[model samples]
Target: MTDAQEPRRARELGIVVGSLPTGPHNALTDVPGVRVGHTTVADPPRLHTGVTAIVPDALGPGRRSLPCGLFVGNGFGKLVGATQLAELGAIETPVLLTATLSAFRAADALVTHVLAGPGHEATRTLNPVVGETNDGLLSDVRARPVTEAHVFAALDGATGGPVAEGCVGAGTGTTALGFKGGIGTASRLVEGWTVGVLVQSNFSGTLTVRGVPIPADDAAPVPEGNSCMIVLATDAPLDARQLGRVARRAVFAMARVGSDFAGGSGDYALAFGVPGGAGDTPPPDDAALDPVFRATMDAVEEALLNSLFTATTTVGHRGTAVAVPHERVLRRLREAGAIPR
Candidate 1:
């Protein structure tokens, strides 16, 4: 379907929120050259797991990569290849997100995928950007079932449109705040630019949406073990350092929604800018970014909101179900006069 048709479809499917309109695709892929793919493992009564690949830019051969940055809010999580990205301020390959225990296998598979693809000269050293969240609840983490084939499938299936969320991809077996949480996404427009956020929604604590708490009486209690990995992407020109700052801003956004980065919660953010004119040039020095910085913060804040807004409730193994009742939530917000009738 066309991009415009996608958002209409999302709304029809009861998968949307907030006042801001979405970009062409309403997904991270809406950010120019960004592309997304997923590989979901749905096996019978249980075993909910999957992988997601985010392809930054698909420019023809030898073009410079995107300027990127990483932020570890708590560092209790496992993030592969972050050191190199932080040191070099560039991500030469697609970013992969998956279950925590599948990290090693995913990283290995990513290396193989990159090496086997076009433009590999055998002399190139690969850094596969793989991030994860614990998904032991629904799948057998010890099995290490995810392989190079699954990684490749996700990468090859990547598309640029409204992405599937909630019990899909890396969010298959995730939980948040003692409830059922999976994946969610949202975007914002700042100074004619767009910033988008995609989150693997495995986190803890009472979920608050735009300052309004999802009251315990109104929703399920927070889960005991939870964590989250947030991926932020934008088309704006931001250097690795600036992107790092943007990444931290996500924490504020998370806090605004009531996440205290509680113990046992692996809250992390990875931010990157899409390569545009002149390809991979460093962003303007900090002093010169005063205007851009303001815009970046706004974008980051809104993106976090989008992540929560687009998520829906899901059911997992052993008949465990979590539901984010949109109608009930809207009713609560209306009672508080948070939205117009």
Candidate 2:
């Protein structure tokens, strides 16, 4: 199942990580009303985990909080609503990525789907925002079969458009650098505003792209609690400290693609802003945030190289992960010319 075959993204393999001009369906739902969903859970003797959902609506409905931010590039993750999303920077619900021991059953199915919505019935104290990484080298991380009806079918099948990368949902049995990573997306359109990115990519190192290291496999192995879970969205009016400085440049665009930040590797990154505080308008002053931090570090390095070019070698259970061989990265992007020989 070579990712069912349409999986060749990363700019169709020419590997163009940034020139800033995307957003039609470059994903992260191209920003407006943003949506995404997934429920993948490969069953077998070990059941690879799953669950993912991100909604982020602007004003018009319930569960509306928005304007969020968090960027612990390496605090090592568990991430269940990072201190009330950094003490009320905002964000109500619908932001669950999963499988670090099922993240409290996906934050108790996102506080029971935002207290079963519809005016929140006089709600009191809410903070569900979950995120995690450890796919346990390939599932069976002590059999935490992510359930809560797979977090209510990834929040009743969250939607908007174009999202589904790699092993799917919480990047089922993730892995990275060594290969078989999962879930990846990208988008950018700056001035008109619409930077988007989504990555789960389990994390390790030596997978570089624009600077070209790409030869992974260094004797294999590479995967532990190794984490990374960036999820960014933008409609622009930013303010949670400019979306935490655009979530610290999306983890400094993941150090261009080859992580060295491995002290177990938590490395988060969450930036949000559908409409942003006190406002009809107000977040863009600081020399206008340097082209929104260079279109969010070029959409977080092409969404972690489209999560290793749409992953597909996953075997999971004890381990397998071997999917970054798109014709050996298209012959090292055509002899380093970066594509098109």
User: Would you list the C-alpha lDDT of every candidate in the order shown?
Assistant: 0.67, 0.81
* TM-score (C-alpha, index-matched) for candidate 2: 0.38
**Model 1: per-residue Cα lDDT at residue 92:** 74
Writing each residue's lDDT as its tens digit, candidate 1 over 213-288 gives 7754444545433667778788776777888887777655666555668787677788888755225454556676
lDDT string for model 2 (35-115, tens) is 888999887436677988887766325436777788897887899979888887877877888878889878987897778
Taking the candidates one at a time, how many backbone clashes does each contain? 7, 0
Relative to the unseen true structure, what is the C-alpha lDDT of residue 284 in candidate 2, on a scale of 0 to 100? 68
Candidate 2 C-alpha RMSD relative to the actual structure: 14.5
Model 1 lDDT at residue 65: 59
Ten-residue region with minimum lDDT total, candidate 1: 1-10
